[model samples]
Target: MHTQRISGQAGQTGRRWGALAAAAALVLGAAACSGGSDGKSAGGKVELTYRIWDSTQQPAMQKIVDAFEATHPSVKVKIQLTANQEYWTKLQADATSGSAPDVFWMNGPNAQLYESNGMLLPLSDKLAANGVNLADYPSSLVSLYQHKGKQYGIPKDFDTVGLWYNKKLFDAAGVKYPDDTWTWQTVQEAARKLTDASKKQYGILAPAFGQENYYNTIFQAGGSVISADGTSSGYDQPAATAGLKFWTDLIKDGSSPSLKSMTDTFPSQFFESGKVAMYYGGSWNSSTFAKNSALKDDVDVAVLPQGTKRAVVIHGLANVAYAKTKHPDEAAALVAFLGSKQAAEIGAKESGVIPAFNNTQQAWVDATPGFHLQAFLDELPYAMPYPTSKNTSVWQTQEPITFAPAWEGKSDVGAVAQKMADLMNTALSKEK
Candidate 1:
């Protein structure tokens, strides 16, 4: 689903995963799966159904498919567009019925679950035989789809977080524009100067979000969400408290809006409406902001403000094949092409996404001349992988519930952090 970037609710990472918890059981309970039979067409063309969720990227995907068919005329690829909300549910039902699509999009949150359940076709050997180089993609993204030393998918595109700001607001406040050298203190000072109570303007949106807000800070503070071995929670650590305190302090100083204000209206609305001066958002926001008439000319992005060190959260979508596909050779051929540099180049020029293939992101950067899209690429070296464990949705759904009080200013940040750690630890313990 590429984290539901194409939608207007792109900023709300919450709505994307709640329903995943319900779909988890269905995925787990499903029997060994097989793909639907969409064999040879009238002209001896072998047709394969490829499923994806983002309509915005469908055109680019179709171009990639067209290229693949140009060489392999006998094999035809059909793209099935399903909305993110219903994508997982329908895939679960299809998997249970042994009729899943031959190829489909997979995200970090669900990669381990699908791989562990044996619903995905491991492509390590197949990729090597196809002369596909894993080195072509960022190592973090490559590692996201691996399970027990097996590669389950090939990264299709990648996205990282950035510090987005309104240039007009910064100019109006007489503050210097943010740059690579900016740090936590710099953000605090700028946020203070940029905020105006009378105008209902804020410095930034310190929302109760994972990928867009606190996760990157947690990493930059030298803290982690899950233990290295993925068996424990790191939220109980002291550094995590510092990471979390960074946001709570902004609320305390009234530089940022109350969690209630953001809750009543999404944080993105505040920024897009020009009520907020700065924001922490994903690279996907590039396309969203470009379409916005109010912000198209005024909004720009920079690397996230450093805490103890510089860091950002990197996440992306991958392409995988069904384990029991009817036409294994055809499916493997399609998957291989989808991960190739040629396909990535097509997507980069047309998809408005950061293609995962190395050296291919510049097109996406140049596509949006209005913003400093390079900020997203610059943080790649220090980017942290989006955290996930087997059955990630179990703990993901609990995060907001467990941390809401702190965000709402009703409980101490440290106290609620420890509570979240305990809750996350219990959930991690239950993963198979």
Candidate 2:
């Protein structure tokens, strides 16, 4: 709950309310719960539960909990660590049933639905009461959690995409280091230069179904994913077709790996093995990449090449308290503490993520050497939020199959793309 690279539309009043809401949660908790509930008895302590997907973040969050307890003697915090996909599904079920934890991670894609449905509390007043300023966190991301004009959560950490290359492959090919101004044409040319068909290696990873790695390109092509009004699909443009063509054509041209080969193995396993020249992905892949000692000192980062636009995707995880919590005050307190700069630093240093708080992120960048993390930070201001909406879960779940035909060559690009836009429009319409 601080901010890193944030995604989604920041509202007109989003940042103003964010600063106030985070502080209000803290103030409301300390004032309303102190000596007011059964929390004061020698045998009883206020228990607040937190849930998150990263098991690696547990120790860091524990440090935050320890700090919170040191300040509030009557409160004891419990942490429940859930890993990736399961975390979202389980959290959804619990929240829908009104049995969610005191505080849990919220993602941009689903933030709108949660906030719009009144499942999340507006924290502006509570943050104001605690006397903290939202200006400390990344204001761009704070807007994602606000709906209609109320702040619902605080950013934890955010990420941006970069062109991660296999250093060993580049060296083997005697290619020079990649620079900031590299373009899609340059990347394709380089991939062609570095490719060794005999060794079963290619220039780049094939485009995938997920928006995380591919959406930014779609955007950069001067294409749109959703309508300007945020009410329908915007993928029917020539830019989108060009964006799709950029990758699939690479596969058709034998510049990138075959779709069949990539289908069996994702970039994580393939690219990290030095079997691929470059792949566009998030900064979060560091820890996983660090495990590849074979590629040690051989891998480096660069800004993603621009298309018609210099666009990048910004994403974040946030802390949101269930509106139906029985221990509202205690829950809010937990949320506030999580959103603090202190918690931000703990998470950044211990979990090794790019911190969400503006001040604490540099330490994370410095955690490793030779990675072009600065490029990622520099890309933030021009970054575009992922095209998420009130029913993002639907989009995320449907994308793999929706984009599959083109990937499989079973359907032509224009027809598949047009149908995709229509289907997306239908889904967004269902939300209305």
Candidate 3:
């Protein structure tokens, strides 16, 4: 969830929320453009706008909306697709001007910010009124969108990271394919063998991102990003340093591309193009890989290699309604329906995302054959909830900047990690 590096645009601003002046301008522009919500189309039917970031999932989302409309008939939902990197900024701008979409996708990193600011409508009372059981979703995911004991969102889908490998590269290097039994040592050995310097190919693509990279290894090494209470930082710990070294060592050994190269090309792209033999990717990439002609046949996923233990960062997206929506009842109804088992199944069948509703994920697995989709579900037992705090974006945005030297091999991991801890602690201290 560390401001996904997939598109590389996230790193361009340095701050996920733009500067004060830019944000003010956005607020002014939004206010000038804002119109009070009508919540009804010219046909007198309730109309709601829904926004989300993943264009890959838009078709499936439309299917969900169609299903919802079938039952209510009076409610119409329009889907708005925004790029991930710009989602939060636009949401903030719209939120400030009381013109945010009636319902929008919310993630762990920004949920607290919106909830605390009273921009999000709490769904607890409505969920209870509808007899919707929170237990149907992952406990961690449910907790993620809750602020001060009030649930502001309903989990839509979830994902976990895995080690994705190219079978052809493993075969050519005479290295065994990665499996549940593989460990850090096994990965290093395989990486060294699979790396082909002459061809500009590396064994793996270890970018300096969190969710798809170091965060999992850090947890696997018995280290955490923050304390259980969310009051302090954990980066300075020895275990944390060891986890970071896992990727830094790969960079040092020429088994992965330099941070500079990864900046130019995302790790997922490198894997898809066969420039890297393996990649630490999230379950969300399943649809992408299935659609990529170059990688569909050769790519497969496995459990992430264990360090001191096995761990994966689990995160999800939730559906939250804007607090100021004129059609509060309609928005709440739409959110409830979207979080229902039926909607979850639709999402799983079409989007290939692990539906948050329990017992509904098999559809996603069955949607794509030949790849081990179960590997993501298998990680649930040891999975760590993606790290979050009230001001997650504040500290998270500092990661690439503070750790650049270490990731680029210009500074020692321990030293850089200590600095990160200091900066993170400073950020945490400012949050209520």
Candidate 4:
């Protein structure tokens, strides 16, 4: 699941809706001048707007669009890029006003929200008619976009978290690099050895972020954020408390920077600046690290350290069509083509992400040979779907607030966990 926050203020909602109204007005004005709603322009060409968040994937998406345009000369695809932080808010505003993009990106966090509200077009029928099998994609990803029994989105790309370490720092501290055999105890030992107060360098950086930091540890420790039935919270359990305390203990022991320090400078920034020896990060960082001149040959990734069990949080983005789009057939066609093996190959070749298409992820591994990219794919078997309920955003928004005292060293981990559980249970109880 994407972790970027969407605007939650009531006033921001009005402003966003106003912005959507203005955008819709512009589109309507243009359409009135052109005089067509069947994807046909005044020039007799079919025009469709495709929206997405990641600028890194735009080149590959454009390549796929170009290929589609070449095959269907009558249809023209226009690319619309939005920053991820604002993408959901804009999409929601547009959806509320009946003017969402013909096709756009969707993630696990908001998939159910849009699908349940009838804002998304279910694609199962279209995929079947076109001879596209859902089995061609990862089963977990296929399930992620399914609400009730209808598939509302097509899997585009996926990511998993891993232990990213600086090899130079490890060598300097005489600590072995993390590997598959590493565990929680092993990491703690390494963290102790790698810390250097004189140099103001830390062994690790464990920020309060859930997906990148604690969520993986929570699962590894045999804990669940939410119960299997999605009816309750698990934070009060001992395993959950242990998972949370692991990081708090690190901060208390000075193995990592204080939470305040990390909040000021994100953990990734600290790792890139050589102030942190190890970082828990997602597979998406491989391309980013490869492009960082300062970290060119100094960084490598390892499977996350294990606890009672080994686990990673798996998630991906999917392409979904707007339910109210004027050009349903054209929009579904674009969504299917984007989720095809050919499009996945283009994404992998561009090093955009691990493609969801069956047997097509190796290109992503080979694209960045310096780091162990396969570690992410190898993690699939033990990966858990990123935790979510119908209204995941509701409780998730409360996480940092409820867990802050624990991260700040002002409260016992168990106490804070109990408070989180109480808060989350109340939220989950209302999810229906």
TM-score of each: 0.95, 0.86, 0.89, 0.89
Q: Clashes in model 3: which pairs? A: none
Q: What's the lDDT for candidate 1? A: 0.83
Clashes of 1: 0
Each prediction's Cα RMSD? 2.2, 7.3, 3.8, 5.5
In the range 114-151, model 4's lDDT, one tens digit per residue, is 67666778888898765578998877778889888899
Tens-place lDDT per residue, model 1, 186-250, is 99999999999999889888877888877888999999989877899889998888888888888
Q: What is the C-alpha lDDT of each candidate?
A: 0.83, 0.69, 0.81, 0.78
Q: Best TM-score goes to which candidate? A: 1
Residue-wise C-alpha lDDT for candidate 2, range 1-432, written one tens digit per residue: 121112211111111011111222232233222221223335588777777766667788789889988988888877887655356556555654446677788878767766766667678878876545677766667777777777888787777778888777888898876787887788878978987789988888766544435577788888777775678776788888777777777777676776677767655567777788887767776656766677757788888888888888776778888776667777777788788888888887787677778878887888766676777788887777666777765655555567767776777777777887887888788777
Q: Model 3's lDDT to the true fold?
A: 0.81
Question: Which 10 residues in a row give candidate 4 its minimum summed lDDT?
Answer: 9-18
The better-scoring model by lDDT among 1 and 3 is 1
Report the number of backbone clashes for model 3.
Answer: 0
Considering only N, C-alpha and C atoms within 3 Å, which residue pairs clash in candidate 4? Answer: none
- Backbone clash total for model 2 is 20
Q: Model 3: how far is 8 from its true place, Å?
A: 6.2
Query: Measured by TM-score, how close is model 2 to the native structure?
Result: 0.86
Candidate 4: lDDT over CA atoms? 0.78
Quote the positional error of residue 198 for candidate 2 in Å: 2.2
